[model samples]
Target: MTSMSFADAARICLTAKYATFSGRARRAEYWWFSVVYMIAAVVVAGICLAAGSVLPGILLLLFIVPMLSVSVRRLHDTGRSGWRMLIALIPVAGPILYLVGMTVDSVPATNEYGPSPKAVGQPVG
Candidate 1:
């Protein structure tokens, strides 16, 4: 899809955010929800391995999409191309660059990744 509605974005997160890599994501949409997903993943992982459990492991497997979505969205917010996320291939610099990139805001108006998501508040094309 070229653009995602608020509801569509949410459903995407729950479904395949972690599976495939495509499209651009807005920062706000990706990061805020990511915080929630991370906490849940950690808790679920712990619970699943807690001696008498396997459910947490299953949940972790299912949780992959959301994790990926947030990361991609974080990249979008930084004003960098989402494909730039591959910078992580480097090793140390990869994650550092990602962290810094995530912290940065969108480049004011727009860059190569289409128009500003903010500008499309009225209706997206």
Candidate 2:
């Protein structure tokens, strides 16, 4: 496949791999998805409030798996195990640590998890 731009990567994460949790995700993919997810949440919450209904909550539920999956993949890209995602459970410090981990650049070479997402012509498995 061709290299994806930030928007394309985010769209793929939200649509094609909505619930997939077993691959690496590049930094651009993760950050773009996060920005879009947050914006969407705000918009949905506003719509729900205006309509006085819980309908928009469904949208949030739909994105939950994709969010987690991308996060796991992003951690993998940084050469960390997906299980490290549990660090997000540590109240404030937990999320901060997780954020820092995700912000780190991907390992230049493959790790136990898979190949680098940013590497061209490399098979992911």
- TM-score of every candidate relative to the true structure: 0.63, 0.87
Compose the digit string of candidate 2's lDDT tens values, residues 28-105.
788888887898799999999999998777888877888899999898888888999999999989999988999999
Question: Model 2, poorest ten-residue lDDT window?
Answer: 116-125
TM-score of 2: 0.87
lDDT per residue for candidate 1 within 1-125, as digits (tens), equals 14545555556577646454444456655665566667777788778778567755776666666666567755654566667777878888888877677767665566665456556462421
lDDT of 2 at 6: 64
Model 2 regions lying over 4 Å from their true place: 1-4, 122-125
TM-score of 1: 0.63
Badly placed stretches (over 4 Å) of model 1 are: 1-12, 15-23, 51-55, 77-79, 120-125
Q: What is the lDDT of every predicted structure here?
A: 0.61, 0.82
Please state the error at residue 56 of candidate 2 in Å: 2.1
- lDDT for 46 in candidate 1 is 78
Best by lDDT: 2
